[model samples]
Target: MWVQRVIELTGWEPLGVSVDWAVVEGELGVPLPADYKELYEAFGGGVFSDSVYFLGRDEGVSFDFLAQWRVGLSVDQDGKFGDVSAVDPYAIYAPGGKGLVEWTPPNGPTSTSG
Candidate 1:
């Protein structure tokens, strides 16, 4: 499975965290992909290889998916992107709206290996 591959590649152990997908989907106003749900359930949230960061259901934590989405929506709504007039405006994704949504931090990923 892809999750197993991820574990092999990143050497990350599965935490087997349980999540209420119905609640999460209700809040997000969208159904998450099955693979993504699987991944989150397995690993929770953490940095992988000090690079990829998985957003999980841990509320109030930095890697909390819903919290990050709210922050992204706020930024989009408040016109926080400075001096980017050329970029086309887009709405944050909602129940029936199609638009941009943040799946990770803007800083991209980093590597811990030196």
Candidate 2:
């Protein structure tokens, strides 16, 4: 229902993201690449508030926007496998506060899109 509402309002659809196993494995027990870490830091890593997540309270700022948010993800479950972790992708939807009146989908590309 909420996902339908979002599509109605923004025309963008919720896409099941694809993850690279090798890369995820690299990050599972070890640190991610330096450039990637820097990017996450730019997104406010230590903070998990809505403001630190682009799809949450970040409104719709581009990756170029310093206020934009991103997560330094690692060892995530993939569609290729049945289960890898406790995090259920279906349980996680893009959260936004301030109601529908103040929501804007990213105009350039999907959050994981380039």
What's model 2's overall lDDT?
0.36
**Compared with the true structure, what per-residue lDDT tens digits does model 2 show for residues 21-86?**
244324343333443433333332233464653221222354322233123222444568534532
The TM-score between candidate 1 and the true structure equals: 0.58
Candidate with the greatest TM-score versus the true structure: 1
lDDT of 2 at 39: 35
How displaced is residue 43 in candidate 1, in Å?
A: 1.5
Cα error, candidate 1, residue 23 (Å): 1.2
- Which tens-of-lDDT digit does each residue in 2-99 have in candidate 1? 98898899998888888888887777756777888898887888886997778978965688888877776666563554422212476767778796
TM-score of each: 0.58, 0.19
Q: What ranges in model 2 sit over 4 Å off? A: 18-50, 54-114
lDDT, residue 1, candidate 1: 83
lDDT value, residue 88 of candidate 1 = 42
